[model samples]
Target: MRLNNKTKAGYFNFLGTLVIMLFIFGVGAFLLEYFVYDYFGWAQWLFLIIPIGCITLFYARGRQIFEYDSDGEALNFKNRNVVLFLDKHLSDEFPKYKLLKYDVVNIIILKRLYVSISSKKSHNITLRYDISYLTKKELNDLKFSLSKVIKNNKERKREPSS
Candidate 1:
C-alpha cells in the first residue's frame, strides 16, 4: 500500500533538528572555547549558523508503506527511519549512524507504523504518519492486509492482553 510521509515533514524535521542542534552547539562551544581557548570570541555565533544552514535533504523518500506478512519481528535496523520511538534501547543504546539520512528501516505496524530510523549522531528519531496521510485505496489495503496488527497497536500496553 502506498503511504504518504508526515504532513509537516520538513517543519517537523526542522524543529527536531533545531532542538538537537542547540544541545550540540551548547556542549561543543563550551568544550572548544573553554578547553581549547577563547579564540572563538565573536566568530562563535557564525559557527553556530553551520547547524542552522545544515542539510535538510530527504533522499530515497517516497510513499512509505508496510506489509503484514512476517513483519514487526526482530528486524535488522542498520538503516531505517523510526517513527514511534518505542524501544528505549534503540534510541539510547546504539552507536550513532551519520552521513545517511534514514536509508532503510525496520518497521513495526503498531498502534501506528513505528519506523525505526537513525539520525546524524547517536540520536534515534521517530516520525509518525497516521492513516489520514494514506490514500483511500492504500488505507483499505493496509486495513485488509494487517488489521490485527493495527488493532493490537491500539491496545494499551500497561493493560494485560485479553
Candidate 2:
C-alpha cells in the first residue's frame, strides 16, 4: 500500500501565495487610506486585522505534507513542511516486525498519526506525522494499514519458529 498527499501540493502552494498577496495588498490599502485619504475609522483597522488573521491561520493549518508507503518488507514514511528549504524533513523506514503500536488523533481541525516501533538500540521510538490534508476515507485507509501491520507483528511474535 502506498498513500501520499501529493495531489494537494498545488492547492497549498496556491493558497500560500494568495494569503501573502492579500497581506501585501491589505497593507498597501491601509497605507493609502491613512496617508492619502487621512482616514481614521474602524474600517481602516480591518485592513490590517483581516490580513494578519489570514496569515496566522495559514501558518497554523496548512504547513505540512505527509507520505506513507507500506510495501515490500518495510514501512516508509515521510513528512516535511511546505517550505522546502526552511524546515527539516522526517523520513523513516523500519521492518514490519518492529512495529509495536499506532494511534490516530482527529480533532476539530488537527489530525495526526503516531506510531511506536521497537528499536535495537533503545526501548522504543515514536514517530509523528501530520494528516490534516487527508480526507476521512484516506485517513481510514491509513489506520487500517497500520493496524494490519501491528496485528501481524503480534501474531508473528506468538508463533514459534520451526
- C-alpha lDDT score of every prediction, in listed order: 0.41, 0.85
Candidate 1 per-residue lDDT, tens place, 46-135, comes to 545655434222212322232223133322222123233522222122322211122222233222444444565877666433332244
What lDDT tens digits, residue by residue, belong to model 2 across residues 22-134?
A: 99999999999988885777688888899999988776653467889999999999887776874688889999889899988877777778899988997998888878888
Q: Give all TM-scores, in the order shown.
A: 0.23, 0.88
After TM-score superposition, the amount by which residue 101's alpha carbon in candidate 2 deviates from its true location, in angstroms, is 1.4
Among these predictions, the greatest lDDT belongs to 2
- Cα lDDT of model 1 overall? 0.41
Query: Where does model 2 exceed 4 Å of error?
Result: 38-40
